[model samples]
Structures are given as structure tokens and as C-alpha cells.
Target: MYNKKSREQLLKEYQKETFLRKTVSFYKYCTIKNPQEYRDSLYQSFEQLNIFGRIYVANEGINAQISVPENTFELFLSTINQDPILQAIQLKFAVEDGLSFLKLKVIVKKEIVAYGIKSHEYDMNHTGKHLTPVEYNQSIQEKDSVIVDMRNYYESEVGRFQNAITPDAHFSKELLPMVANQLAGQEDKKIHLYCTGGIRCEKASAYLIQKGFKEVYQLGGGIIQYAQDQKKYGFKSQFIGKNFVFDDRMSERITEHVLAHCHQCGTKADSHKNCANQTCHLLFIQCENCAQNYQDCCSKSCQEFVCLPKEEQLKNREFENKRLTSLKLSTKFRPKLKGLQKNAV
Candidate 1:
């Protein structure tokens, strides 16, 4: 029911495995009779298949981003498809992958995507219209339609649609309400919504409708599908730059455009990294040069602290982050990476 190995041991094991792994994400909003029972079974099934990733199971549905062994993909697929709740569901494969996860974690939560809205706020049964990637491209260009990015500010900071109404939201709980406020007088306008995997948009579009907004439409499978469509259909991507992912890889480049600048230095860069200093693990954009100069740390002070004796590090760990915060050290983005070849996409 749990991994017996330490984090270091797990990382080493993942690195040593020679098998190809496929990183993918999927979600569905469906009824579940018993969430705890389902969670237990799901964990057992994924564990047997040597799966590694995070998953959330609730009375509403399931959401997961997992890494599967390439050789056992079919087995994983067949096993998953057998569940009535998950059968015929669409899966979004990562555009690029590295060591996406080190351990498998299945949690039981109140909501899968965490919009923090009450039941009276949304009606999933009467949700927004679904638009294919090609259809989305055509519709978004219309003068009357408004494209809104239903994702966190940091996620959108790295990549987003050209003319999107990206809310300055730092958390999912605040995004929908902020978006509603932003579109206050535009209830009659055609509201277009999208998120990483289309999950967030599902609830958001519905909420907009409940708020008296008409003509709500969501990107069918979100950006993951859009990127695939662009590659296969040879259409210019409306969304540019890196798609920030919740994984070790941080992001996957969607185009050649470097939309973000390094937090430490102002050069164009899109790579995201947490400060290597355990006491000051602030997430920010760091260029390779700064990464080397600071030893993968956010500030020189923290870098120096990391080199102290083990007992010293422990003694200062509690106060280190507080001191850094008081001094306003390290760079922070607006409420908030990857390098890719131009011709690769």
C-alpha cells in the first residue's frame, strides 16, 4: 500500500530503469458509489503495473497524471478501460517527458480539480459546448468570442493563447471568480474556455453559464490535444511558448518562442526550477547561467547556507526562509520550463 524505499532510493531506481516510459494525463467527471473503495482498488492496480504519478479519486471522478512503462502500456490501458467510470475516456499524452514522477500517490479529495465552488454554482449536465482544436482555432479568431485561459497565472506565464484573458490567479480556488469579475459586462459575449487537460474548463465554463453568461465553449481536450493537432494538421499554433506541467520536467516547449524571461537575469528563458536550498525552495524561472552561478539556488545567501555542516543546516533551516523573505531575496514572477528545437515541433 506504500513505497518502502526512501526518496533517494526511489530516484535512483527510476534513473536506473532502462525501459521507455510514457507520461500521460486523464480526467473524467462521473459518479462513484464508494470513493474510498475505488481509491484502494485503483492504487493496487497501478502499483502492480509499476505506475508512478499522482492521482486523485473522489465521489465526482478521477484525475491522474502518470508515467507508464512503454512495454506495458497496452496492459495499463486495458486495465483502466475495464472500469465503467473510465471506459472510453480520452488520455492526453505528454508532448515531452523526463523523470516525471518518482513515486505513486493516490489521494482522496473533495474535488478532483479544486475550483472551490459549491454544488449550486455549476451544472455539469448542462455544461458548455465542446470544440475541436481546429474548430477552436477558427472560433477564437472571431471578433465576438473571448478566449480565457482557465489555468494558474504561473502556468499561463510560460505559454498561452495569443489573445487570451489570462486571470492573475495564483490558485485554482480563486480563478473562476476572478475570471467572472473580469468578464462582468460581457455576459452576452461568446465565452471560450481552456485549461491544461480540459478538466478545469469543464467546471469553469459551467460556472460562467450559471453566472448568466451565454455561449460558453471549452477546448475539447485542452492544450495537450491542441498541440497534437497542430503537429498532425500543420496548423500554426495559436498558443505559443512552453506548456508548464506539474512534473519533474516542469514544461514542454510548444513553439520556438521564449515567452518568459529569467527571474534572476532578464534574458529570454523559460526553464522553471525550485531553489536547490531546501530551506528556500522558492519556485522561479532560472537561466542556466544563474543556475550555475548560484549552484541551482535562488540566492547567494541560501547557496552559502547549503554548504554549512549538517547540524548547522538543521539549526538554520527554520529561520533561513523567513530571513530570505524579510530581505526580499530571490525573484518572483507574476503571482507565479524547457528548451526545444525550432524544427522539432
Candidate 2:
């Protein structure tokens, strides 16, 4: 097993690495007979190769967003291909190096995308046509084509294709129904869909087709591969702004355009970050100035908790635990908005 270390130490070691690395993302939707066994075997193999990133395996499918040293990327691919379950999986390559993740974490979840729909809603056998970047861009020019962004609101806030219809869903569970409702009357239109790495849209396209959409298509490898193809073919990029990602490095700038504002300061910033307070890790965007002033906490409560002496903090945690046990109170943490307190305002 790979030895665990502090996040600070891990960050330092990552900065010290001399070689370049590639960030790759991919997902597969298929029934898994043995999730635990599959996860363990993949973890062991990836650890041996020093591969690092987050991976999710569940009954429905597997999703991965990882970075591999350039020299070892080919080996990594070959190793994954050797596994029968992942052999024919289509991997999406990133456009530029984003230094996406710092460590490898494999988690077992109930569902990979968390759509919360019944199994009968989608058939994996029938999915939308996978169009390359060139094909996708060309199709968008057609008079009847409708393009949609298949990510959440915060993700779309950073960057998206010009004129793409962005659904106002806050979570994956809300995304499908919202998209379906938004395009309800346009079932016969030629629809082009995309997401960060193409996995969500793959299943989404399948669902849409099942819902009676006539012409359904998706960016084969999503924005990441689309960017890569843009460089190779010297084609102008149709998408603008940053591609929000889930990692220590929250986003990759696809273009120089800054299309979003920082949640804290309203500055032209597209960066996204989670609160530094472990107990209140609400995802938000803050400019550098705000981050410095708040010490990366989301609210005053979190800031005060973090500032307490170690012993005091531990005592409070113990007290909180006792309260939960005695009162049978729920211990689940909910994200707090920054400006809720009058003092903060």
C-alpha cells in the first residue's frame, strides 16, 4: 500500500518533481460484478506506477481524473488496457497540463454520476454519436443545431461555448431532468452536448435518445480532447474561458478570456476553491485578496475555529461529538455561505 503523508508534504514533493506530467480523465458506465475487488486491484497497480488522482468505482461504473508523469503515461495506459473491464474504455486526453491532482484516492460510491434514476432509464448499448472536435464544431454551424453544456452552474460560469444553453442545475441529480425539460419541445432538433470529460454526456445522450430526441451527438472526448485537437489541426477553439475541474488545481484556462467573477470580490477571476476549513469545505471562488484576508475559511465561524489553539480545538470537537451522541443530533456538515453574518456583511 502507498504510505500516506501530510497534504503539505505531498504538495512540496509534487512541486519538486522535475518531469512534466499529463492530466487524463475518463469514465465507463457498465455493471460491476465486484466493486471492491476491482478497486483494490486497480489501486495496487496504479500505486506501483506512482499514478496519482481521484478515482470512483461503483456498481454502475467507474470514473477517473488522474495525472501521470509523461514518461510513464504510456505504461499507465497499457496497464489499464490489460484489465478486461477497462480494456476498451475510451480515455479523454487533456488539452494542456493543468497539474490537476496531487494524490491518488480511490473511493467506492453508490453511483458514479448520482443521477438517482432507476436502472431502466438508460440503456448503455445505445448512446449518441461521438463526434470529434472538427465534426462537433462543423455541426454547430448547421442552422438547426442546438449545443448544450452538461455541467453544473458553477462549472459553466467559468467557461463554455459561445451561445451554448447552460442548464441551471446545482447538482448531477438535477441535471438530467432540467436538461430534458429545457429541450422538451425541441426533440427533433440536432442536439450537440458536452461536459468536462465526456462521461456524463455519454450517459446523458443515451437518456436523451431514449427520450425521443431525433439527432443526438456529443463531443467525443469533451472539452479536454477538443482543446488538444484544436492545437493539432490549427482550428480555432469554439469554447471560451476556463474548464472547471475537481482537484487541488480547480481549473484549466482554455483561453485568455476571463468570463467569470470571484464570489468574494466580484473580480474577473474564474478560479474555484474549497474552504480550507476541513469541517466547512464549501466550494467557492475567491480572489487572491479575499483568500489572504479570510485565511481561506468560508465564514467567521470557521475562521475562529481554525484560529483556536490545537488543544482548544480538540476540546470543542470532543464536545461537539458528545452533543451529537447525547442529543442524537445529526453530525453532517453543511456548507455555509460567506456573507451570512452581519459582521461579515
Candidate 3:
């Protein structure tokens, strides 16, 4: 049997199939003796059921985001549950699901969340308290409480909890130190944390506790679960705006609030788009009006470049790189935004 094919072929075949599918995401951090072996085993099992999506396995544990067909969803669950390590894991369903992923991929990594902190620095066994959405909502309302958004600035730019302290770091490596410094003097304050999924907060809350944070709590299952529970329990959602997602949908609307502005015109907008220029696929926010005006480019220069012939476009990239130096290009979207806060953890 042919077990592998190009992504184009796989997607084309998937399009022809009429079966309905559901996307389910879940993660767990525990010791895995042989990640490669486990990855291969899981991939084969999932392949038999025609599951598709990305999954990462590390020595620490497994983090999966997979789409299973409706007919095989129960069997998929039971198959994974048969493995003692992943038995009875809580699965978070996507608010909007279709063909969210094009293919199945099981990768092996060193860390599931990739916070770039030393594993010895924080122990997962001693992680922070996991709070339900209701408990998380009430804790943030307490006096002297600090809510820190664990995702990148772009992810939080579209949606985050009210009164949450969002770090300006662009990369995951800069997150821990930045957050630590931001909360430096507030060691005794009740620290509430959250992420797109709950993975990042797992390590973040643990690190905060090691830094002498007296109390630390994380939104159980992060925003995905919060949105689900809020609807199921009929509670008011304090998290406003869009939840930036990695899938094709870009974001999941948590509430009606649009808290971000279009990067080009500064119009009230929360939708994110990649510059139409394939080489300069810079991610930024653009309203429908600006998206039409700019031809979905991050800048007028990119707009022009994308319209050029393939050969000319490649030649222009060399000159464009010189014009947009590393520093200028990195902060192009926020030329006038205030400098990142300098606080000690």
C-alpha cells in the first residue's frame, strides 16, 4: 500500500471524499521513553482511521491537533485511550470545524510548547493551579490580581481577557523573561495566565511559581474551552474580540468586540491577513476596505512587487531586502508603538 503522497494529491483526494470530519485538539506533558516509536505508532493508528492534522511528540509528552471523521471519532478516541499515557485525555473541539488541516503530520520535538526555558528550571509536576472558566473569571476580578496573556502579541492583539497584561514580545523565546520582568515586583499578586490553548500556560505558570509568585492560575484548556463553557453554562464572556488561531480560519470569534485596528489605515478591525506577496508574507491586520485598496499587501511596495513577473519579483527581493533592513522590517507594522516595558521578574 502507498502510505505517502504529495500534499496536493492528498488534499485533492480528500476533496473527493464525502465523509464529514471533526477537528479535535488536545495535549499532555509527561515522560515519554521513546518519542519516535510512539510517534510512528500513533501515526499508523490514526492513518488507518483517515485522521488528518498536526501532532508533535517530545520526550516530555505529546501535543496533538487532529481532525477525525465523524464516523471514526469514537474509535479514534478509544484507540488513543488504549495507550495508558493518553487515556481519558480531555479533547477540545474547534468552534468552527471543516477541513482545518490538509494532511496528517506527527512530528517529534524536544518540547511541546517551545517556551525555550531549561527543563530543569521548572517542574511540570509543580505547575500552577488549573482553574475553570468561572473560577478564572472571578480570580481576575480580585484585588491585586494580575492576568498575563501567554501568547504572542499578534495572537493577543485580536482577542484577550479584560485587564490582561499582554507582553510585546514577537517570539516565543522572549516570552518568559519578558513576562517575568513585567511581573517582577508583583510577586505576591495573584497571577492569572492563559493562551490560545492551555499548553503555553502549563510551563508559564510553573515558571512563575519558581520565581516566587505566591499564587498562580491558568485558564483550564485556554480560550477554546472558555468559549465553549461560556456558551454551555450561559455565563458572560469577559474575553473580547477574536481568538487568533493557527489554522486556515486565522481566528475564532469569541465575542462581538473588535479590539484591534487595521495596520495600514488604523480602522477598527481585528481580522489578520498575510501579505499577498508570497516572499513577503508578513502577517498583519487589514480591514475589508483596506484589504481591497492595498490588494492584501502589508505595504504599497509589497503590493507592487506581487504584481510583477516571477523573474522580476525574485530580482526585486534582493533590492527590497536592502531597503527594508532587518530592524525596520521587523517593526514595520508598529513604527510608533511605545517601547516594551522593562521590568524584572
Candidate 4:
């Protein structure tokens, strides 16, 4: 049986252990009839090997970001491949290695990527042509080519291919419409797509094809693999700055170029940090000076709120919720405002 440890217990266990490993991220979109059962089996298999990271299984497919012990990496890969559905799955190793996650969590979700698009919106079978890192580099140089970054604004703000058209949309659901609207008149032009680990672009390219866009192409393995491939062959990297990740590290450098600035002091920085205020845990960029000045909060109000006692903090949240409710302001769109932080940075 798999034991579910509390957060404190898990952190304690992680701190007490020293393991040498490399973290890798990968995803695959394939029909899975019994995601719960599949999730359990994977948990049992990986847990025994001390693998740690997040994974999601869905009826549509699976998406995972995991850290594996370098010594047993071959065994880990083989174990996952033992399942016919996951056999020969393409794994993209992170550009930099660290204990990115402290525990293994296999969750069952409605969708792997969580784009929230209707099933009828696109045909995955007819996705865009896959391009290797070398090929992707060449395509972006073409005069008629449109390089679209299929990721959140914050992700692209840190690092992206030169001349890539990063949409202003914040959420994944808003990307299709924004991209479609921007490229409305150039349906015949060559459009190239890229994302964190290629999973987002998989569905995005398919969506564009369904919208009647011709000559669509996607970076074969997104930025992660592109970084690895560039290093393996000593190719000059076209991607500049850090690659924003959804792990503890938050971001990794693919190039020495720092293209973004801190949100507070406007100093050149590429680091992303979550506001320390638990209730207002806004993800934003802050330099060392701002971090110290603001105490890791996004705003002065958030910093003050975090300084309150726990009981007072809870009471403040209750009052805030009531005030918003009384004002008839909906909270559903709060997540969409995350992109604005990047613009402010």
C-alpha cells in the first residue's frame, strides 16, 4: 500500500535523505480508459524507486514531470515502458538538474494539459509537422514564417525564440482565440509553435490546423529538449534567458541572456518567486533589493497582510471575501490576471 504522508512529514523525509538524481519532464496524449487504475499502478512502481514529482493521468492522456535517481534512471524508464500504453514514450530531461519535487503525486484529472477546450474543437490526429531543434532554428529565420510561443506570457517573458509572437493571453484557454485572431489574415503563411515541453504545442498545433491554417509546424520537443539537443551537439542556442517551469526551481537558464526585469525595481532579472502571503500567493518577479524591501510580497498590502497573526489573517480573508461578494465581483477571472504581472515586470 502507498502511504500518503503529510506535507511536514514529506519535507522532513526529503531533508533527511540525500539522493543523486536527474529530473525529467514528459507527456503523451493517448486514450486511457481507466486513469485511476493506471495512476495507482504508476504510483506503486515509481514510489518504490524513490522517484519524486507530479503526474496527471486522464481519459485523454498523461502528463508528467518527475525526478529519477540517476543510478536507476534506466530502470525507471524501463519500468514505465513495461506498460504497453507508455512504451517508447519520449522523455525530455530538464536542462538543469535538482530536487525539483519533494514527493510523488499521481493525480487523476479531466484533462492532462487543462486547456479546457471542447473535444470537438480539434483533431489531434491532424496536428502540425514536428520539427527538430535544428529545423526549428531554420524555420524561424524564414521571412514568411510566424513563430508563436504556445505558453503563458510569464513563461515566454523569461525566455523564448527570437521573433516569436507570444500572445497576450494569460490562460491556456485564451490562447486559441488570441492566436487565431492575430493570424486571421495570414492563414497560408508558415506558422511555428513551441512550448515548455512540447505538450501544449501538440494540442495548439492541432487546433490551428482545424481552424484552416496551412503549413503549421511545432518544435519537436519544446524548449527542454531543444536545450538538451543544443548542448549535445554544441549548436548555438536561439532561445534566450531562463525557461519558466512549474516546479520548485520555477525557472531554468537556457542562455545567459536576461531579457526580463524585476516587477518592483525594474532591475534586469529573470527569477520568478511566489508572494509569501498565502492568501495572495501571486507569482511575480522581484530583484534582491525589492525582495528584501517588500518581504517577498507582491504589493505593500500583501506584505502587511502577511505580517498579521494567523487568526487575524483568516479573519481578513473572510472580510475580503464578503466585501468582494457584496460588490458582486466575480473571483473566477483572478487567475487570468497572472499574466499582467509579467507585463508589469
Candidate 5:
């Protein structure tokens, strides 16, 4: 009923694997009858293929971010392409690959994206116009066009489309409403929305239309596909910097424009890393120098905590746990990973 293997054990197994894997994400917003049954079917197929990543299935369709073994990718694609519900699904492939996911997770969720909107708020059938990268680039340059980044603040901090409005929100549940409020009174404007993949924009464009916004459009396949298209066809990318992802490879560089600074030294850097200390695993940008200085930890305190002996560490952990527990909610998005006390080498 439960995965008994320790995290260390799982990681060792993952590292030992000789096969290659490719990460990709795909989603759709069609009616899915009996989600549990669909979930089980997906689990069986994915498990057989030794796939790893998070997946969500709901009555409104399925959302998946999986790493498929290179050997089985063709058969896997054929299986998905043959499915009536998932036929012709658009997949967003990762630009570069690393340790993507440790295990497979096929979850039964209420909504795939978790926009927290009522059924009346969005009509999936009436989503915004899907525009290709070329079309999007041209449309955005036109008058009365408003581009919005439909991802979290952390995601957009490192990279975004040129002149796009990034909402100051952490998670999806908070993002949609904040964007709506920010774009108030611009209902007639040509609202263009984008995400890592095109999934978020599907419901977002519909939600905007419901709010009386005229002329909503979305990136045909979002940043991942747009970047690939630009490279393949030899065109300048309107999107700049990295595309923040949820996998271990935090981001995939789209354009070489460094848009973010190192959270530690204030140097120009966009690479994100979780603190080496498992307890204070804060996600923040750290430059190569800081990575060496702080030993891959978020702060001096976290670095020191990691250096403590195993026996003494448990006693110290009791006090550390209380402090972290209290600060957990406040520092969820903007953690103590920001300013550090002069990093000691």
C-alpha cells in the first residue's frame, strides 16, 4: 500500500539505471468519465514502461509530467496517441534532462491545474485562440495587446516573454485571481496568456473571457514548444531567459539573456538549487561562487546545520524544527534563502 524504500535507496536505484529518459508534459481539458478507472489504467501502462513523474487525472481530463525511457518512448507515444481521450495530445519536451523524477505518482485530483474556479467560471470548449510562435510574436506587437505570464512569480522571475505582465503570486490557487485584479478595466484588450506548457492558459483564457475580456489568445504550445520552433526554423525568440520547471532540473535555458541575480551575492545568475540541508530545503538562485562558498546550502545557518554531527544534530534539530515550523508559511515562496550574513568560504 505504501512505498517502503527510503529516499536514499530510491536515489541510488535511479543513479544506477543505465537507460536514458526524456521528460515531457502534456494536458487536456476534455470530459473524463470515471477518473479512478482511468488513473489505474495509466498507472499500469506507466509502471510497465518504468516511467517516473507526477500525473493528475480528473473528470475534466489528465495532466502529466513524465520521464519516459528512451527505449520505450515510441511504444508509449503510440499507446497515448491511440487513446480516444488523449488522441493528438500536445507534449512539451524538456530542453535538457537530468534526474527528473524519482518515482511515478498518478494522483486523482479535483482539477488538473487547481485554478480553484467554479464550472461556470470557465468553459474549456471555448478556450482562447491558440497562436503559433510567429503569430504570437506578431500579435503581441500590435496596439491594445496585453501579454500576461500565467505562471507563479518564482517561475517568471528567471524568464518570461518580452513585456509580459507577471503576477506576484506563489501557487496557481492564488495566481488567477491576482491576474484578474491586475488586468481590471482592460476587458476589451487583446489579452495574451502563457505558461511553461499551454495547459494553464486553457482555463485562464476561458476565465478571462467569462470576465468579459474580449479577444484572448494563448501560445500554441507555450514556451517549451516556442523555443524549439524558434531554434528549428531559425528565428529570434521573443521569450528571454530560462523556463522554470517543477523537476530536479529546475529550469531549461531558452535564451542566453541572464534576467535574474544570484540570491546570495547579487551577481547575475539564474540557476536555482534547493539547500543541501534537507530540513531547510529552500529553493533559491545561487551563483557558482556562492554554490562553492555556501557548499550548496541556502544560507550560512543551513550550511552549519549540515556540518553538525549525527548524534548532536538530532538534539539541535528539535530547536531548529520549531523555528522552521513557525516560519514555514511565511517563507514558502520567499524563504530565508534571500540575504545571507556574509557567506563564509
Candidate 6:
């Protein structure tokens, strides 16, 4: 049996916990006869296990990235394994710990990865060959190998494999097409792809292959699993900088190489952050100094906006919405990192 507290109570317990927990992610692509029933059953089971993370269920499949207590990790694994649909699924474990998420969120969505592609566009049975870290490292050295990063610009900014071609698209919907177009001429080349975990590459590789790519390969478990395997295999990590994650942890350093600049100071830093202003949470990177100086706001305008009275802020947001409609300014703001004191260095 499992127990669950309210979201507020869960936050309180997290604050008081003394033991370190592990953040892990896994996903599987399978046809579901009834998504609603599947979603409800999964929610009931995972919640009981006391798991904390975000899960997206859809007709296409399931995608999840979560953090669970080390004590219940085995139970969590066993619970999922017992499921007929999820049994024998290969989970990609994270190499570093950042306490990625604070609470559990199970959501039913349209598509697990949300590529906006029709269901008939990709064949899940024909995904790229999964290569371990050693194989990925060796394959890239071949004369015709082309490595590509299949993540958002912000995610690749923090950490990515050396010489990996990063698509300039900002959102997931645009990423697939841009990557396909970029590698159009190199169809016969040995195309190697990777993402934070293996999910993005899993679909991207299959899509590319469908688009005529001949020798497509994906890093077995993305960088997370690659970093873990590096310990035992003693292979020099080709990835440089921190691996950006979606949860509260933000990013994890994978190597000594820092190839990114601080978004504020343009210095040698690769840390990613969301603007601290609740009203406008734009995702970007800022160094420690900039983080301290700006209090995590994306700009001075946001800094000033956050200090206004609640009513005044609401009025201003309404006004800005009308004014910015023609200009099409994004209202998204970066959320403040939890557990860390607001604006406290």
C-alpha cells in the first residue's frame, strides 16, 4: 500500500528530508487501447508509490521524468515492471543528481513528445540502433559520421557532445524539420543523434530514417546513460559542459569543458535558468554573478513588474497583454528555483 500527502505537505516533507534522493527518467512507445483508463490506473499506482515527477500519457505512448526516494526506488522499479505494458522496458538512469523534481504530476497529453506529426508519419518499430557510450564514441570517429543534438537550443547550450550539430530551432515542433532539412544532403552519411535522455533521439532517428537517412545511430541512453557507462568503460567523454534537464535541478555538469557563455555577462559559463518573475518565466542561462545581480529576472522590466502590488500587477498584465498582442511578446516567465532562497546568493 502507498500514502500521499497534499502538495503543500509534500513540499514541507521535502524540506525536512535528510537523505539524498535520485532523479531518474524513462519512457516507452506503445499503442494504448484506452488512454484514459491507462492514465487513471497509472496515476493511482504511481501516486501510491510516493513517486514525485511529471508523467505524460497519450495514445502514442508514455513519457516520464521523475525523482523518487532511494528507499523506494526498487519498489518503484518493480511496480512499473509488474505492469504488462511497461514490463521489460529499458530505463535510462541519470549519472548525476540534482534532485530534478519536487512533486509528482501525471498528465494526459496529445502526444508524448509533441512533434505535431501525424501518427502515420513515423514507424516506431524502425527506430535507430541503440549504441552504448563506447560504441557512440567510436562511431563518431569514423570518416562519414555526423553527430547531431536533438534538443532545444537552451538544453544544448549547457552541454552537448563535441562536434555534434545542434539545430537552431527553439521549440520541439520546429526541431525535427530543421534537423531533417540540415541533414538532407548527408543521407548516406553515418548519422549519429542524441538528447538528454534517449526519447527525443528515439523518435528523431526513426523520423530521419523514414526521410531517407541510411546509417542513423543514437547514443544508447543519451548523455545520462552515457556518463554512467563511462565510469566502467574508461572512455573519454566527448560531451562537454552541463546536461540541461527539465526539472528543478536545471542542469548537470558532464565534463570539464565549458563551451557556453553566460547569458548575462557573456563569460565562460553554461548554467541555464528561468527568469524569476512569476509572470514571465523565459528560459535562459545566467552565471552565478548575473543570477545574484538580477535576482533571476530576465530583464529590468520584469524586476520592476514583480515589485508592484498584486492588484497593480494584475492590471499591468492585462494592459501589457493588449499592448503586446500586436507586438506578440511572450508572456512566459522563468520560475524561481525552489529550496534556494529567493535572490539570496
Q: Pick the candidate with the highest TM-score.
A: 1
Write down the lDDT that model 3 would get.
0.83
* Per-residue C-alpha lDDT of model 2 across residues 1-345, encoded as one tens digit per residue: 445898889889989999888877888888888898889898999887888888888898899888888888788889988988789787777665767777888777887876766768888798999999999989998999999999877788889999899997666777888999999999999999999888888889988998999899999888888888887898888899988777656677888988888776789877777677654556677788878888986556667777988878787986644543443233222322222111110
Q: Estimate each model's TM-score.
A: 0.93, 0.85, 0.89, 0.90, 0.91, 0.88
* Residue-wise C-alpha lDDT for candidate 6, range 5-38, written one tens digit per residue: 6767877888888776778788888887788888
Which tens-of-lDDT digit does each residue in 1-345 have in candidate 1? 767689899988988998989999999999877989999999999898999988888888888889999988999999988988788889998888778888898888878878889999999897899999999999999989999999877788899999999998766788888999999999899999988888888888889999999899999888989998989899989999988888788788999889888888888888988777865566788899999998998778878998899899889877875786665533343113111110010
Any residue pairs clashing in model 4, and if so which? Answer: none
lDDT (tens digit, per residue) of candidate 5 on 73-104: 99888889878888888888887787878888
Question: Candidate order by TM-score, highest to lowest?
Answer: 1, 5, 4, 3, 6, 2
Q: What lDDT is obtained when candidate 2 is compared to the true structure?
A: 0.79
**Candidate number that wins on TM-score, 5 or 6:** 5
**Clashing residue pairs in candidate 1 (N, C-alpha, C atoms within 3 angstroms):** none
Error of 5 at 310 (Å): 2.0
Q: Could you give candidate 4's per-residue lDDT for residues 113-146 as a string of tens digits?
A: 7677787889999999999998888888888999
lDDT of 3 at 191: 92
Residue 237 miss distance in model 4 (angstroms)? 1.4
Sort by lDDT, top down from the best: 1, 5, 3, 4, 2, 6
The TM-score of candidate 3 is: 0.89
Which stretches of model 5 miss by more than 4 angstroms? 1-4, 328-345
Candidate with the larger TM-score of 2 and 3: 3
Instruction: Give the winner by TM-score: 1 or 6.
Output: 1
lDDT of each: 0.84, 0.79, 0.83, 0.82, 0.83, 0.77
Tens-place lDDT digits, model 3, residues 1-345:
125788789779888988898878889988999999999998898989998878888999888878889999889989988989889898998876666777788888888877889867787888889999888888889998889999888888999999899999777788999999999999988899999779889999898888889899999999999998888998889899988777656788999999999988898999887778765566788999989988998788878888899999888888866655553646755332212111100
Of 2 and 5, which scores higher on TM-score? 5
